[model samples]
Target: MAAAAAAPVWSVDPRTGKRREQVAVEATAAEVDTAVRAAHAARPALADRAVRAALLRRAADLLDAAGERVIEAADAETALGPGRLTGELARTTYQLRSFADSVDEGAFLDVRIDHADPALAPPRPDLRRYKIPLGTVAVYAASNFPLAFSVPGGDTASALAAGCPVVIKAHPDHPATSELCAALLRRAAADVGLPDGVIGLVHGFQAGLDLVRHPQVRAAGFTGSVRGGRALHDAAAARPHPIPFHGELGSLNPVVVTESAAAERAEAIGAGLAGAMTLGTGQFCVKPGLVLAPEGEAGDRLLTALTAAVSDTEAGVLLDHRMRDAFLDGVRTRAALPGVQAPVTPGAGGEHTVSAGFLTLAAAALAEDGTHDLLLEECFGPVTVLARYTDEAEVAAVLARLPGNLTATLQLGADESAGRDGAGRGARLLADATALAGRVVVNGWPTGVAVAPAQHHGGPYPATTSTATSVGTTAAERWLRPVAYQDTPPALLPPELREDNPLGLPRRVDGRAEHA
Candidate 1:
């Protein structure tokens, strides 16, 4: 018999369990440094707002025109369906436009000028300050949102918008798609006369490490596991001249269904959670991995509804083999815990798919034992562990025990949800929930991240490193730092900081702040 052609290098597709393509991994430290230098050299021209906005608009146009091609490429490489890919592409384009709009708004410049006035008692000096680009950014693409968080994702877009060149370390899971998107971005940059080297990508773990450690890299942006994010964060911190590392590490996003809310509409909440937990196979950083529903008949009812809803949905394939194996392993680990029951045991729905389901554990077991704490950690798959609380006190205690998260949700009824009951207790509960997360959802699932200026898509601790800014429009702030210039001549001052303000941007002039 003739020899079979080496089984066409295995690559899993999330939508359909099949091989898509064989990705080539070839790059060395020298090549990476060359790319970074090219990007660094090309930074100044691309830093202009008009130039960057035009590049972003060109990218959005390309995404719109060739969206289908991009979607197909992503779906083939990731096993994600067309429907999901389509939505992700839209989000990616929307994000590009959002950044472009932010550039036009000029608010991201954040200009503040304390003009010289020796006449005052304190004799204030000409302290003119504004944000400046951090040279080059090293972005680590995510496996789950290949397009939206990948080569052409928010990190690259935001970095470019902030006038910093980007060097992306593509995720190995979907390298082909990453390459394709990189090509499109390069073409877009070329079209607008922006340097093609403004954006570069590399594949492989070693390459990622090298990129992070590259001396010229001014700052970093990451969206991945806590382990990976922390490693990069530590590396950046340990560097000779340490740079800021803005990472959205990981989160066991928790949802609390107050006793009254569960009693009012258990079924609706259960069904909604099923969708959230399994959306993209529970790969989102904002997925409600931990749910706190008060115990008693109401909690049981919510559990039952959740079980039925999750059981009905077919198990979807995770991002890659590593994630799939981890999900299965996590589920098994949690199930082995005492007082934990998988009312709906997740199973392999298809060749590469795993079913969606929930596991129930008593609040006491989680509180009393350290083993159960593992159940609270993120499994990164279509599995949620519903911790049943016997009463409000137990719920509060468990809430207190939770690590900081990207989002904390509370499902409340008309009376309780209003936060203005006759007894004035509702307001207290609302305030308490808001304090626990970066984004607090009153009655909705936390999975859907809306692209808006007001959104704060970050949280405390392991959820994110520094809590001063968010990962939305505010994410640009991370790549730029404020520098104050004092007692400088008009000729020496930056055009934006001069008394006449040629750019017509908002600034604090004289003693009063004004916007033009």
Candidate 2:
């Protein structure tokens, strides 16, 4: 018999440039099968709304209890500061609790009903509709946001909230944190008297591929680079029973400042832009990669202030050397392009650090056919591009060429009013911004994403695999599918869809919504 191959998981500390901990061995194909089957088996337990809510709350409590240890491990592996990691842990726990509330409310099911009507020319039969879980979800972890976007992150929380089991493929960068989180979640499931495999953790590249290919995995969620997300998306599609793949690939989230707005808030906007671009070393997927500003005194003042702010900014280390190398390479590529000038040239600050910076280019350059088109893509670090526009027409044209983003911001002047009349200059700009991004900000930056009910963290195409979100309360919607019960008996129908409304769920009856 042939011997099995070994996959060792190691934690590399970015700050020290050394491997600090050996987390675990990667899961083999047989182990992957075991995890998936266990998750599939646990789907029955998840059917109980009370059980689901309890499990989520237990997980949140356990995470809260392990607060200090979790934060320290995450910071040790990711090199994200203790303060930042602590804040991320808070957000992570808050998201878990939020999902618990969502599961308890049961509104994510979206139940509806219509009685039989035989009097009309073509009367419809009795019909009812409500969403159900799609089964096990394979969640791919992100390198950044170790706690919030990894192991016990939004994807995992949303899946569990939707009554779907999650098998998380831990990001290679933070294996220790992943293991710790998985243990806490498993303990929570046990405390709630749920199945052990409600949350599974696997390490290594092969396990991730196995997860997507497994027939038991009915859906998947990912937050990562375009290259990786695209590959996984294709693999999931090629499966016999293709599942929903909600992959949040990166974005070049663009911003536009009206000439007058820049004039009025030059210093404030400049400092704010500097802060946004460098937030988390610009690791956020929604970091503004491009900005459209007019060419005049206003533009110059903004650029000068922005340059000063960026220069004043201290050097910072990235997640890892691999990310640092990529950031440097991307900056070099952009700087070499025609009409691209490095106003704040971003590159390696030292053997271990990356400096914040920006690039300048004429807005017309973006309208050109070939080279400038690359500027529309994300650079993935503390770097941004300033697209200088000569006129309003040029600004509009530049915005049109950009791809969809998770967010698009338009800093408007005092005179600029967004009204339906279409007579105002910025009013017309609203439509353009709306067409480009999922979340439109009029006078703010895109770095700080809130965890709220109305939040939308996904956008068109490359921004995400679908229009569904991977954050906030509505994120669970991605892991669900609607089923219609036509001419079905009352007892045979789901409690939420039955005439009695035993579950006390909100539903629409006879084309009218009923609160009870």
Which is the leading candidate under lDDT? 2
Which regions of candidate 2 are displaced past 4 Å?
Answer: 418-423
lDDT of each: 0.82, 0.90
lDDT of 2 by residue, 75-167 (tens): 888778989998999999999999999888888888888889999669989999999999999999999989899999999999999999999
Q: What is the C-alpha RMSD of each candidate to the true structure, in Å?
A: 3.6, 1.4
How high is the lDDT of residue 24 in model 2? 94
Separately for all candidates shown, the number of backbone clashes (residues 3 or more apart, or on different chains) is: 8, 0
State, as a TM-score between 0 and 1, how close model 1 is to the true structure: 0.95
TM-scores of the candidates in the order shown: 0.95, 0.98
Minimal lDDT window, size 10, model 2:
414-423
